[model samples]
Target: MNPIATKYIKLNTAIPGPRAQELLTRKEASVPRGPFTTAPTFVVKADGALLTDIDGNTFIDFAGAIGTMNAGHCPPQVVEALKQQVDQYIHTCFHVMMYEPYVQLAEKLNEITPGNHAKKTFFLNSGAEAVENAIKIARKYTGRKAVISFERGYHGRTLLAMSLTSKIKPYKYQFGPFAPEVYKMSYPYYYRTPEGMGPEQMDEYILQRFQDFFLGDVAPDDVAAVILEPVQGEGGFVVPSKRFVQGVKQICEQHGILLIADEVQTGFGRTGKMFAMEHFDVVPDLVVMSKSIAAGLPISAVTGRAEIMDSPNPGEIGGTYGGSPLGCVAALEVIKMMEEQNLPARGQQIGERTMQAFARFQHRFPQVGDIRGLGAMCALEIVKDKESKEPDKELTAQIVHACNRRGLVILSAGLYSNVIRILAPLVITDEQLEEGLAVLEGVLEELCL
Candidate 1:
């Protein structure tokens, strides 16, 4: 193999070297195939934007644990907080004994989440749980059973979340008897807007369809909430126009249906804002947060208007591990770190740099069909050809694998799985970011050109 000359990446052996191969063998034998993993090796250590594998190979991490590490891997403040909290006490079971950190974090969320309205916040264990609870609260408050989600949107994997999610192959295939009263609506995909429709026209068209939908399908009065991802994470990083988002909010307002923003993957400075909803100048009645909220901690939260959140009385919601002390402490430190370090502004810089590179790639490669993003949350759609715009799923997979082999960990997104997405940690330095991008550009040149 050609010698690698770099500062961050150190590939002393081929991927899955002896030690990793041994682990991989054991993993295949012991673990189920259902849980998918992008890289085929086990990590020994991770910091900032780099990961070291068990086999002594180091790589630049561009996936950021699927957007869970916006504060970077094991951020010093979060790690230190976790260390201190672990020694003090672990789980007091927020329900049984309660903890100060839980309430503190909730207050912080309520203060920071969009709007000046009086709001309340509660914690959960995962993004899916937050979504489920948000829907539950909306239903209870509105006395409605129907919920509306958009096409190509992804919520999570649990029963109700899976039912609302748009993907089928890995997430929902054969997961029968999905939750009842969940409806799907059309979200604008500007790139794929039908033949002659402009983005504005498409936005209006989709918004108008809601009227017909209320008439033909579930009535607006029966809808409890309309859940949206300001920038669709798993749906190929598709971003909606301000008009579309506001239009949806307006419709929800007219029908007295609550609007829920699912910020699972887009929260915590991923999209140049603390929450993606801020980009549209729309304030959702309810918000679901997780992923980067606690820098990989298994904690999620639902923050909403006070009256709506109070709909679920005592003993109606919450779980044993929700808002564990460790998660709360770590999240507190994460929020402080984000504010002190100004990561949201950093996210904007990353987005600018990445989009510039993507623009260059589009000019050079015929397979580059479209480049789109909202902030640091960016993606490049791979296609058979620019004109046809047929999703090149196979090529997309090949590009991801090639970049991985070259020691740049990346990921693919989109309903068709034909888009390369960048979720690199906000803490990544300019040199590290450029090197990782170089690796990706090289792979694209080799595979797509």
Candidate 2:
């Protein structure tokens, strides 16, 4: 570990740490109304994979800012680059005037993404913007009006993003009149087994369902794109089988429809691979990436075959804050950090460690139900009955709260909210991870045993 990351704080009381509680009070008075906070602690500062609360208690970071900061908190190279770029310039709309960092980062993304074919990239300020722009590009390129997305997949919070996203209770309950021409498909989640369906049954049911839609409801040629996450994120850290992913690719190819891989959460070394799609041989025509790309500096992009990307007319895709100098500089440094640390390989190693740690829990706790994941990204779906595999949402939430009290912050997902998703920073110390997992086991014991 670097000198900048060796510092650790001591915990003395219930989290909010007194000072954080005061800040939380001030936040209720001044902060925006929409942002919902999960924890009682208010951070004073963060370094490496640890966050210091207002009272100076340190907590191991597991959320990674919802899949950002994969390079870990305030990575030295990225922070230094941000500092240096601040002295130059902040924003100059790329459409009005080009900048070196933007062009350079785009080049890096194009070259690094899975493809040797000619490709181009467009920068955006957020993941939602990138998804929205991808729709524009796909529509322009294919001259089609319909798009298909998977169930339980999370795109973003924008109006159109809501339509593309499939979760109803939380993401889409009252947000009506979302963008039109968006269709939904079932994501391949093997844990719950969908209607008590087996793997082979699930595969056939999903395929036949899509075929029915294509033949009965909509014409395949009218479909512009089918957007999917290589590995589902917020919906659950569901890792689709190689057969399922390849089957989807085949369907898209048969209809001449474009395939869009939403790697916003899975990209930038979240999975063992740089992009989650690398686990399989399937190559998508377009790849949407964000979150950790810039190591938390708010940069996102859509990259793929140049010919399709070029279909958009001038002024079709550009943002004032898109690909800011600081963001691009941060991204370049993030890439350098990944190379220097071999983070992708490290991600694979972390996955192995997670498996080892989780296996012990599986043996002791029958309610573990299922343990599934890849690289540094993984999740365990809890159950009411191990044999029945019924979603135990209440149990999962209890486990999360217990873990929080133990100083391990974890996030939950899945269609029924019974899954515990773990997305730790790829650079977290092995000792921290082991300690966090041990706390997590204790939380499970309290909830299940």
Best of the candidates, lDDT: 1
Candidate 1, run of 10 with poorest lDDT: 1-10
Please list all clashing residue pairs in model 1, or write none if there are none: none
RMSD, each candidate, Å?
A: 1.0, 3.4
- Per residue, candidate 2 scores C-alpha lDDT tens digits across 1-449 of 11122233246677766787788889889988678665677777878778777776777777888889789999888888888898888877787888999889989999999989999998998999999999889999999999999988899989888899978877888879889899989877776676667887887788878888988878999999999999999887888888888899999999999999999999988889899998988999999999999888888999989999999889877888888888899999999889889998888888889888888887778788888898999888888778888788888888877666557777888878888888889999898888787778777776677
In lDDT terms, how accurate is model 2?
Answer: 0.85
Q: Tell how far residue 365 is off in model 1, in angstroms.
A: 0.8
Query: TM-score of model 2 relative to the true fold?
Result: 0.95
**Regions of candidate 2 where Cα sits further than 4 Å from its true position:** 1-9, 194-197
**TM-score of each prediction:** 0.99, 0.95
- Model 1 residue 322 lDDT score: 93
